[model samples]
Target: MNIRKVLTAVLPVALLCLAATARAATIGVILPESYPSADQAKELQLGMTLALKTWPGDAAPKLVIKDSGCDARKADAISQEFIKAKVDVVLGNWCEINAGADALRAAGIPFISSNAERVKAQDLQLQMGRIELNAGEKIAADLRRQTGLRISARTSCWMDFDAALSERVDAVLCPVLTMDRGRWDQVANTYGAAFRKPFTASSARGYAAMEVALNYLRRAKAMKPAAALKETQATATLLGPVPAADAPAPTTALQLVFAPHLPKLNAQQTQTLDKLVKTKGCACPGGTLRNGCPRDSGPWGELPFVVRGGGTPAACAKAINILEL
Candidate 1:
């Protein structure tokens, strides 16, 4: 073969191969820069980074990160940018995803979120599907049934732990996400070592979102991306699975109970206290003090704070007045 003829053929083939090798999926990430705190955003990014390191593919997806600033307009703008860039998928926290839902859907790009608010009628109108780990409404409904109380689901992205401590809320219901304690511990240890901080629920959610995105890409090879995600079964993750629409709601919830410190009582005093609690009746919405007073439901001063003098109804009545004073 002539030198020029052979060289031309080899170079074109090599270039094609190189181009194929360089081509990788693009994943757009929208994270808050300041709204929830810079530390939280960093934690989420670190979790995604950890997942990328464990990617089974020869070539990992390219990450295009944008600061959403937890603003709806900013998130929408970022979504438009991702659409222009032709990203295969988008991963975001609670603050940014809902704001960008329409744009991402129009672009035919899948979106995965770590948290979600109670689904509304408007949310149902969106064509693109969302894979959310924290389903607040479902969790709240389950808690209501279990506790026989009015449980309100959080509608905002801000932290609610402080609200739980306030006088206005009776109790805060938290869901236990980790299905495998052993696996969670392993991941948490690795995350701690890398970030120099304890692994948080947000971090776990971020890692799980990436895992789900990768799973979607794998399934997309055989089917459309939307269909693949829709057909995605319960994937074992640090936070259990991406709940199927028809899946049963979680039966358990962790309720953070708040109550005033009670005086230590002896065996006789304890027996007397129980009797008094049942007879006196708790002023809270839950009906009785057997489960402790939910101060949010009624005045704390109405609670029988002193059972010291005697377990009689009159003694409890007098104690209540003293507490009020």
Candidate 2:
């Protein structure tokens, strides 16, 4: 073992280590584990991991996953860890996003949400899945065709699967991710094999969101939060185009329409609803009534309203109206 032999081997090992470190990047993921629907968090992470496998390099982006528990406090704590480690990007479920959005924003970290309704355009908050929020009109139209009802005003059904509610309402619209039929079937098979359980729709969004995030990472010159956000919004994903940065929030309201005889609200309930409507003022876009449940009240009649099940049409049909607020 002479000095010359030792130097040659040490130099090669050092060069390899340097190259590996230079090419590697870190991505922080916040998922809700040990909380409601913990399995969803696991499934989502699996999807993200599977997508990362397709990255075009040997030096894959290193992932640091933290359990957010769907709580603001937990999410913030996990985000602090991400900040300390200087992660290149952060992605999470909507609950995690809602919990940690403020902290991540203040830290200048871009947060991509896999499932959530877009609340106005925030600089660091990017919504990725099923961004459309208002499906009231579409639900009503669907109801009309199915029940042959002259229904106009849209009422929200808390429990969409109830057969009784379905019989009464012209249609009950539930907000859900519309999966790509072909890819979903494939993913389902993969997920079943990987998890030893059935695949959920939320799992699909998790997979899609990660795929989109990776695409953005690949295209960006510098993986800074602002640059990533700009590039992602400007481009389209395999699923489709991301929403325009300047586009107004989605107006898709889920609704359950009733037949000709609208359900009547009790005196106290009616008063409460009326007050709620007054408080949520603008039933139209750009209105002053900030607290009111905005309603089309016009031919569209596609306002956002909620209906609860009861003994009869009166109890079952009663609804309270409001917007994202």
C-alpha lDDT values of all predictions: 0.57, 0.55
Best-performing candidate as measured by TM-score: 1
Candidate 1 local lDDT, 273-311, one digit each (tens): 344332433323234443444233322123212122334
Question: How would you encode candidate 2's per-residue C-alpha lDDT over 125-204 as one tens digit per residue?
Answer: 66764434434455456545533444443332211112123454533444434446776777678778776877765566
Measured by TM-score, how close is model 2 to the native structure?
0.60
For candidate 1, report its TM-score.
Answer: 0.63
Please list all clashing residue pairs in model 1, or write none if there are none: none
In every candidate, how many clashes are there? Answer: 0, 17
All-Cα superposition RMSD per candidate: 10.2, 10.4
RMSD (Cα, Å) of model 1: 10.2
User: TM per model?
Assistant: 0.63, 0.60
